[model samples]
Target: MQPAPDRLSDRRFAAIAHFVEGSVGIKLPPSKRIMVEGRLRRRVRALGLSGLDDYAAHLFDRGALGAEAEHLVDCVTTNKTDFFREPAHFDFLRGTAVPRLVGQRTDRTLKVWSSASSIGAEAYTIAMVLQDMVAAGARFHFSVLGTDVSRPVLEQARAAVYAEAMVEPVPAAMRQRYLMPSRAAGDARVRIVPELRRLVQFHSLNLMDPSYPFDRDVDVIFCRNVLIYFDAPTQAAVVERLAGHLRPGGYLILGHSESMAGNGLPGLTSILPTIYRREA
Candidate 1:
């Protein structure tokens, strides 16, 4: 009367893959079927379904896709990121990009966008770096905006709480200055300090959208690691849309492993293998 609990019908897996790709630009191939099943298991259990078969039935047969889609997307897209992951990017921003922008501006303000910020680590890391620059007499004020498509991760980003071990990559002085250790004895958690938290904000944004609803003249945009999940066309389109947001002379930083070699980003020049500067 029922299909095997572990078997997600190939047809349903195809449907899920299509929806994921269409909704978020994340290409989930058949090779990722097992990953999809594994991530969806908890959702299936929560819905009191016996397995992926019942879950797919609930979605497609019972007309639950519209109601369940966001949660479905959230379950699969919670990517792992760390404070100061890929430290060299921040070093480049601090040493070269910031100074270049400062020289080009009469105002003392900077805008940084973490286009795929996950759980706020990347945004807060930027704040920590910028605050240190200010302390060292870099004359500028800065704001950081962290956006992601997943609501659950955006909620985590807003809360700004992290396990103690999550902050390990943060340098000692920054850890002491930008993080607030839990007052509860034996508790191992920290919150971004109020000062740093005030400098950052988070919102939900699906990169697949034709146009973003924020400032177009962003000074620095960190869109790392995320493009890998997309197919070449989606990656190029997303990069184009992001390039549209950069101010002239602004920088777009990609993950070390990601590149724009064949993307044909017009008006953008390669600063490094992974960094591009908009034409001034």
Candidate 2:
């Protein structure tokens, strides 16, 4: 039997670390070295490479390997988000954030950003909520934008297709209103209705960049469960970039387990548990 490959030789590990840090500002911990190695082992074998070192060399030597590098990053990075994953954040947006902002607004439009939206669920959820709010005499124009570093996932988000299981938690009434069931090649799939798709957009964004652009001021930013992957310094940088896009008096929602206390955004005020407001 072939000997097991060396997962983390100093050179190969450094290359992987540099790729992730440069691309997404995420610093993979030493604890994850073996985990990354294990995940990529199969890919190396499939490529007819002998070990991690061989694969890393190929990644650097070939231009076509860029896509594979991206695939590796996507595979290693965590993307465990779901629709309405953090119910309280959505609740605060519907109950307090929207009403408070609308009361003070000169215009009816509300712009929201999902800073690390994965697979479009979070953005779609926001759209669904806004649709309900609009139907209930809440006359508001809304746009939900989702941004992520993973190109593959962003493509999936743009496609707006999902397994039926993904919609299970979505309220039946809303599901009926927003999703259409269809048979594609004899397999059933749920597609986001044109109305919801029109309200949301997805883009590729690198959070580490100091000068991130927002097309318009954002009223609510849903950046949940994404910051835990970064180091303290990177986290602080990301928070600052995200805060720059939020409209005054708008809200920035973080993961239930994440905090912005030490990241230096004093303008943020905790309004409802995990929900925070950007002071006007």
Off by over 4 Å in 1: 1-5, 261-263
If scored against the real structure, what TM-score would every candidate get? 0.97, 0.90
Give the alpha carbon lDDT tens digit for every residue of 131-202 in model 1.
999999999999999999988898999999999999999999999988899999999999999988999999
Scored by lDDT, the top model is: 1
Candidate 2, superposed: residue stretches over 4 Å from native: 45-48, 60-69, 185-188, 261-264
List model 2 lDDT by residue over 1-280, tens digit each: 9987576677768878888878877787688888888878877888898788788877876654677867778868787768778777778889988998888878979999999988999999999998899998897889999999889899999999888888888889998999888766765679899988999999888787778767537898888788888877777677767777888898888887775532346677776656677776
Cα RMSD for candidates in order = 1.8, 2.3
The deviation in Å at residue 199 for candidate 1 is: 0.6
Model 2 lDDT, residue 162, Cα:
84
In candidate 2, residue 68 scores what lDDT? 84
**Which candidate leads in TM-score?**
1
